[model samples]
Target chain A: MDFSAVRSVAVLPFHDLVGDTRAADRVRDTYMGMLLATRAVYVLPSGEVNRGIARASIRNPQQPTTDEIVKLKKELGVDAVITGVLREYGKVRSGSAEANMISLSLQMSETQTGSTIWSGSSTKGGISLADRMLGTGGRPMNDVTVQVINDLLDQLFE
Target chain B: MICSTSCSNRFLLLPLALLVVLLLGGCAGLEHTTVSSSGNTDLPARLEEGALYALLPIENLSASRAPLAELDMQLRNALKERGIRLLEPERLETFMREQRMRSRGGINLTQSRALRDLGVAGVFITALETWREGEVPRVSLIMRLVQSGDEPEILWIDGVGRTGDEAPGLLGLGLVKDVRQLTAGALERLLDSFVAARSGAEPGTAAQKKRHQPKYRYRAADFDPAAEYRVAVIPFLNVDTREHAGRIVGLHVVRQLQRYGNLKVLEPGLVREALLSQRMIMQEGPSLEAAELLAAADVLGADLVVSGRVFAYEGDAGESKVDFSLQIFSGIEPQVIWTSHSYGGGDDGVYFFDRGRVPSAHELAGRLAEAAIGDFAQ
Candidate 1:
């Protein structure tokens, strides 16, 4: 589980369990934004990663197998690979109170050994005290998403 | 030591008059709509400013069969005005014809490879999602810039939705009376945002976010006081449209329904999976036989199923409008328990001026869904 030697990582598109087809790309993009801000790891550009995916014909980029992970590492020239699943993304309500919510989990694996190194999940933003008292409807989706990724990154660095 | 009655009355009236003036002043502004830009703001840094670009034929998703040639023309002019380089119109036309390119709004890798042959650096694609004509026009336009190479990638994607009366200034001077003006304004705003983002300005520079307030209402009888309800929202059926209007509206409804603490709304993916497993198809419309509804509810472990159709979702002018209806069925009895229809513009609740206008069909749909599902919270 030592993360000292990890350098560049390719973040594949997150699998979306939310019915909205657009959620996957949106969530992945937001995650990348926050991840890039951390300066903890060098991430491969999404364009190159997507090109590699198409070249390899990886059918399920969200759940790449070990063989596919190795192939992606060879194709994208990255030391590590990251994949994720978006369990929830959008709005939720508790009685009359409403707020934006997102639930997602991520896993990172070393490309050479094809061994899972780090894993984390985050769920945040739902009917906060402010939403209940002041009826503010909580933070916007973008803000909530930022917070979620921040939480996951915090866990990763810790 | 006593002041005259007239003097005391004058003093009181002056403050009241100022208060009235201040309130009215808040409502007195030009009609304007805010554009929210997301996606890769870092695109500009990677793009060569002087590189030649190509504009794909605009995609029209509006219900109106209006000719989009004028809009395309305007787009070309707008791009040129911003000093963005583009291929010659005639050359571009001939290339599209020769290549037999029918695609719009997006450019794939193959297309990008082909465009690269012409020494194009990037491709600009636009979609006109809503175009309505009336006293207050509404228009929604989405534009994307994709770099053309072995790996075609979207550099920037932004959308602007505006209604003609979005910001009627003092005495209504700011109302966008013409669709052309609204369209031009939207394009300008989008390009400005892109430029600002590339120039290292605040990428999140967006208009003030306004919260949706309930302006309309439809009340159902009542839920059993003691019994908790499980709700399932299914895919909405689209009528006379090529757009994914149905799914968009359904998501809005799901978002609104989840705001209630008493209802356990099932994830839509599970509902879709259950339907697929049972091989249930409601292709014609969302209407289902009572038995079919009950079967779906049973598999989803829900007490109610929500389904509907999108009739009209237009925002191509100055006032965006959404028209859709939803019906709820009882899981146990296959009986219809609630039905509601919503059809209105983004400017529905604006009183004095444009302060409360919505300006986008997406946001308006969310608010309307909130109104239709308002009774659930009670």
Candidate 2:
């Protein structure tokens, strides 16, 4: 339940609810990049995480067992793991030409215990009454995803 | 008292007459068609009320956005109503991720072991042929109920294709079914069919009593009939001069083996991924070395590993010939359990004055695949 001692974190691949893997990957990268910008917790790069996965020869990287977690701890030397599922993501079109939306759930867990310390999710990007009346669109998918990640991180920090 | 003998005939034909009139009235758009093939009726007895079964990712052939998840949810709800246990979606997802099996893809060997450890009876894999939602809703699905075993038996295989339904009329006058009614009705009917089969037939039926077990083609002493088994089919060794011949044949064999319902066939992707992870490069050969086969079985947790190789493939624009051989190796030990060599001729061989008919590579591979493992049905 403590984030003070969580100096470094590895974000695992997020499951794609919309089945658009490219969008999911982009969102995860955006989150990691934004988290890195805060300079609060040093984030492991996805490439490094992938190398660790290949090194561990994990059967299921997303659903790692306590034993697999132990291996990952030794292999990647990460204090915490951030896992997520992308629910609604990618570009959406409304009365306005094109808009983007993102709905995602995330959990940060200690690698040693695989115990969750914090969890959160958000759905963003919809046509407001103003936008509907003016015939305008909301932010693009990346911008919306970044905003959601930022807000969620703010909550975690608080 | 007033009915004559000829009058009785008129009454007998009344129902048929109504059906014809209904067809003429454009009621033909909604007669649901179902095709099913069932193995031993006793096979259903394997499903217990509370036994948990994993559902492999449903193969989505329809051009829809991840409807498999929604459809699977509906299916699980239907199953729950029947007191059937299913693997929790998250649990299955996590387990597959652990084993590196793709949700939209396959069942691997090691993943099968995990399912067993989780105390699952078997796995359900389906294919969505058509899933159109709207005014004229249509749903077509091919369902496979596979038993967990060394050769996982596909106990029940059913296919349904239906679009809307006729609305019920007063006194059988109107035959109309709404989209919601059609979907729910078809789903319930399919579930009932599965449950009834699993509940078992009356033990005293003549078919059950006769019990005609056909002669198996590749009989080896190690072919244990008692315990359920999962089989991992590694990419076949390609020996033909043509490229990807073995892979094509392997694909056909996997498809055919999948239809049998007695073997928990490992998805080819899982096998490929496993081999790649283990740094074991699958080469073009008739069979794997004992150690290599053991490694494959280790990764797949399969009881048996089916290895194959293509020997001959020759074809031009219109004619083709193919030959292939297969061998089953046990994961328990470093030995071949069974072996079969087969060959087949393909293409119509119709001669055109300038251009003769030629079989494509896939056509040849399919023929060879059928020839090699056709007896597996028995």
Candidate 3:
């Protein structure tokens, strides 16, 4: 989590395990917007990063090889890259109860060493006690998503 | 006892019938009507009604998991009802499987040739853009007819988007509660236009839907208006929160480009096929990079390439907002020829009580796109 060597980062598209085809892009977009707003680290424009990825001919976007990582850095002029996976992101139901949920993990790797510099995971939202007691639908999906992303960012910068 | 029971039942039904009649009469002013209309009805003259046609699988571009199978069936039935000869479903399915055609949303030149060999004259490519079923239902469907020949050219294309509560009568009881009925009404209107065009009725005149002189626009000074340029529209980058906003905007731009007589707009499916084959991915959004633009133009055989970004396409509480920018690059050289930025809300010009307010984001996007490309026609 050292910030000395990491000046810029490329956030790859998150992998979605959820059945929804759009979950990956939607979550990644939110992450990009929030991460950029923090202004903690210089983030490459998604278009530039994608161009680098395409130019490198990386077969797997979320899991680029070490050599591909170096190539992406050379192409995009970024010091580090971030990859993420969305394990569960949507509404979950248990019998008669339903609530929004998000489970995600992210890792940052420096291009020079091509090794993971920092990694974090976050999971939030479910059928809560208050939700059940009041018979409410729980938090909106966007709220849960933002909360999970915020938790991860806090860990990343800690 | 039986006679007494029958008499009681009749007495009960008479009052209920009377009540129904009274309510209907009272709510007559509030009758809701399904409004479905299309743009661009000028179909190719060579298209014959007797020619056999096949409906490719309807593409579901909507965020909602609309019943695509039901829609396909409905379209097939509607085609049959209109006396249009369709290829046998089993035969078409077999051909699709044999050819390993993964994308039925569009037909490439090779597929078109193969269909021609199979005695099919044309193919229908349909995309269900929007389908929301609830208290107020909304449906948007776009259909295109491509001739199955050496060159797979789009013969006719039109789309219709409608919301259930688009027109509420006196009591609001006229609201359409069922999505299927709304879809049917839209389909009926689309077919009517197609039928009318085929029967030699003059295609509806192009009406000016939206007009705005762009504040930021660039056009090449030496641009020729009569140039026969082949154009390919890339999927616009969706930076908006709305799902599929990029594709929707791109489609609207394509529709606008198709209206220009000097430009030959390439089928989006073919453009997609080329992009995939070339392994060119616009990951972030539209890129103005010289190398990539030239590569795309060469691969797609496009004289001009169009790319764009959608910043906003959202509708909340009956107000619609759309913001986007479009850039057209020359294929011969990796340089921009035309660029324009457009942004507006549904109530932009509405002063009085919502007389000119746009009802949905889809329509607003269409108008913005039209206004952005308005100068091109001149």
Candidate 4:
């Protein structure tokens, strides 16, 4: 349960389960930014991670397998790899025309054994009373995203 | 008080039943309305579609992202169907993911670097105004193409809108459909412009489009567009009611000039910096006497200064209106080289609203920007 040795981590592409690849990418990024802001670990440069993905010749970057993580660790020289699945990201509407829904889950795994060290999931950014009454919708995805990431990281870091 | 069975609860039952009926009957009045977005562009022919192109995320202005997200996917499929080769979305998303994290959500060097790494010929950026599903559908999409590199240069742009020809609903019971058919129809016509430009063929969808042309006037008759000059466009003196109208219009003018691929337009940031160094706020309109312009231009290392004012900008989902004036000053002499005044609005809010000509504020702004540039930009 100790992440004391987790000095460095690299965030990989998240699986876009709901067919919205952009939402998946966006949510994964918020997670990465939150992780970086923690100053908890030396997050490997995104450029290096991109290069590692390319070097590994991963056909489906969305679902990075254990071997790919091992390869990324070797190339990027990171201790752990961060990856996640985006179950549901984007909006649901009842003629309101507002994006007030988001859902995602993430995890950080040990590279050598591909064993999960820490994991977190969140389903936030939903409609509220004010949204329906005013027809204005709920909080923007960005703000809600920060809250979601904070919740996830708190579970992992604490 | 908690009602035991039927005595006190009878009163609550009536109100609850009424509420349910009201909610159910609310949609009975759902009237079907047709909204169209007509778009045509002057994009040149002879594009290399087989070469690599990158599609950035579309800017969703309609407060919701799901519809636009679907539109983005539809656009990719549509363009691919039209024989355009796009950089794999996974790789592009990967690059952007890093860019977001490293730049902390700002436009940074990563886009340029990613463009280089991907070895793309062009980048496709777009804005989705209205995309939804129903018997009577609405769609407005504007696409902007920029030639790739460190400094991505604008190549083409156009805004379009169109309404689905759906039959009237029986007491609001029917709405044709959503997503599949509506998106297919819109994307078919929308992406066709890319091919139309290259094949030198007229687009069938653009048949109803009404093109607008803006005129120009210059104070200095001898000012030449052929001259190689670095131009600076200061923030407009916005008299428009819209907040930040001046700043937005200035940016629009810069993009318009940049798209022309002529006239060395200095970065507005550089002009702002120079103005700041002079302890001057360049928010004033073109009335900046030629001497003041010359000083600002000289300090900013420019030969021409473009200044303007956005007098008005009004718009809604149905249509939009704008009025503005523009002027250009020569850095060497205290003389105004050129000036222009123009205004425009979509033909909307009429009995034939469906058949009328209505352009968005952005499209109208583009028209004004073109007029602002006039001969100089070309």
Candidate 1 local lDDT, B140-201, one digit each (tens): 76666777777565566556667666565555666777887778788898788767655655
lDDT of 3 by residue, A1-158 (tens): 46777877889878778876567666675676567546566565455567788888988988887888888888777889999989997788776778999999998888986788889999999999877777677786766877988898899888
- Name the top lDDT candidate: 3
Given candidate 4, what's the lDDT at residue B376?
Answer: 49
Tens-digit per-residue lDDT, B317-371, candidate 3? 3566776767676666654566666666766666543345555565666566666
- lDDT by residue (tens digit), candidate 2, B1-378: 457977998987998887666554443222213323233456556666678887776677544544666677778888789887788889988877776775443454455566778888778777664455665455555566666644344555444445442322234344323445555666776676676667774211111111111111244554664456576677666652355455545655665555444666665646665666667654422222433443453565767777765655544222345655566666665444555555544323333221222223333344444444444434
TM-score of each: 0.47, 0.38, 0.63, 0.45
For candidate 3, give the lDDT of residue B50.
83
Provide per-model DockQ scores.
0.01, 0.01, 0.10, 0.01
Q: Model 1, which residues run further than 4 Å from truth?
A: B5-28, B31-64, B67-130, B139-162, B169-378
Residues B1-378, candidate 4: write the lDDT tens digits. Answer: 355666668878998987665544433212222221211233444256468887877766433334656767888888888788898989878867875633211122346556767788777777665554554555556565666555444455445544443222333334435546655765675566556555554322212222334332434557677777767777776562465566556655765665443466654434654665566543333332432544553466567777766656654344566666666767766445665555566542223323334434555565556555644455
lDDT of candidate 1 at residue B71, scale 0 to 100: 86
Q: Judge the docking of candidate 4 as incorrect, acceptable, medium or high.
A: incorrect
Better of 1 and 2 by TM-score: 1
Off by over 4 Å in 3: A1-158, B1-44, B200-215, B286-298, B315-318
Q: How much is the lDDT of residue A43 in candidate 2?
A: 67
Q: Candidate 1 residues A1-158, lDDT tens each?
A: 56778877888988889987556665665565356545566555454577678767899988999999888878877799999989998889888889999999999989897779999999998888889988878876756776888899989988
Please give the RMSD to the true structure for each candidate, in Å. Answer: 19.7, 22.8, 12.1, 22.0
In terms of lDDT, the poorest run of 10 residues in model 1 chain B is B208-217
